[model samples]
Target: MSYEFERESLENADDRIVAGRAADGDTVAFAVLVRRYTPMMRAYARRILSGSADVDDVLQDAFITAWEQLAQLQDPGQTKSWLMRITSRKAIDRVRVSRSYTDLTEMELPAPERIAPPRQAEANAGVAALNEALLALPDAQRECWVLREFGGYTYEEIAEQLDVSVSTVRGLLARARKDIIVRMEDWR
Candidate 1:
C-alpha cells in the first residue's frame, strides 16, 4: 500500500497495530504514532525540563531515537510508556549536559491556557505559584517530583532514571511536595 493510504488507515488503529507496523519499518505508521503522541510527549519533556527552552530539541531527539529503536520494543502494546521513557531520558540527558537546572535561579513557566472568564482567575494564580515553587526546589527534588507526578513514572522507574534508590526517590518526592505546599499556602 502507498504510504499515504497506509497512514490514513492507521489513523484510528490501536496503538499496538500502529506500533507493530512502525517496527516493521513502516514510516507512515511511525508518522501516525508521532502525530498521536507528540503533544503529550512535548508536555512530558517540558515538565521534566522545567519549562526549558530546549523542549523542541529534546522532542526532536526523542523522535529520532524512538524511530531508530522502535524495532527493539518488546511489546508494541506498551508503546506509549516506551515513548515517554525515551522522552524522559532525552530530557534528563539534556539537563545533565547543560547542568542548567542547577543554575535555574528563575524559570519562566510555560504559559497557561487562557480561560474564558475571570471567574477562573484564581486558578491561574495557583498554577503560577506552583510553577514558581517547583522552580525553587532543589534539582533532585524537582526531578523526582516531575517524573512521578508529571511523567506518571513508578517510584522504581524514577529511581532507575535518576540513578537513586527507590527510598531516595520517595524522600525527594516528599520533600519536594512539602516545599511546594509551603510555597503555595498563600494560594490556598
Candidate 2:
C-alpha cells in the first residue's frame, strides 16, 4: 500500500485498532494516536501543573513512556484513558520535583498591551477569574478537580491515579467546587 493510503487508513481507524497496530510495531499508528491525543494531554497537563512551562516536556515524557509500555496495555480500546493516566502521573511527578526550588525568573512580569471588544473583554475576564480561582486551590484539590473535570477520569480512576481513597477524592472535589464557586461569585 502507498504511504498516503496507509496513513489515511490509520487516521480513520478507531482507537482500539490504532492502538493494536501500534503495539504491533507500526509507527504510523502510534503517530496517529499522538496526533489525536496530544491536545487533550496538553490541556490536562496544563491544568494539573497549573502552568505551561513544563507541560510540553511532561507530555513528551508521557508519550515516550506510552510507546515503551504500549504492549502492556491489556485493552487497546482504553488507549486514550491510558495515555491520560500517564500524562497525569508525569505532571504530578514534575510538580513534586519542582516543589523544592522557586524559580525567580518565572516571577518576572510579561509585556502586556492588547485591549479587546466588550464581549471578548467580558469573556476574557471570566476566564481569567476562573484561572485565578484554580490557582488558589490546594494542590491535591486542584489535581482532583483537573483529573475529574478536565481529564474526564472517573472518581475511581482518579483515586487510583492519585493513590488516594475514593472518599478523599470526593471530599477534595467538593471542597474545590465550593471554593471555586465562591471565588467566581466574587468576580461577578
**Which candidate comes out best when scored by TM-score?**
1
Off by over 4 Å in 1: 102-132, 182-188
Which pairs clash inside model 2? Answer: none
lDDT for every model?
0.84, 0.83
Model 2: weakest 10-residue lDDT segment is 100-109
lDDT of 2 by residue, 84-181 (tens): 89998998888778752222123322334664577566766676777778778888887788678766889999999999999999999999999999
Q: What are the per-residue Cα lDDT tens digits for candidate 1 across 144-184?
A: 88788767899999998888899999899999999988998
Per-model TM-score, in order, reads 0.77, 0.74
Give the C-alpha lDDT of model 1: 0.84
Model 2 error, position 39 (Å): 2.4
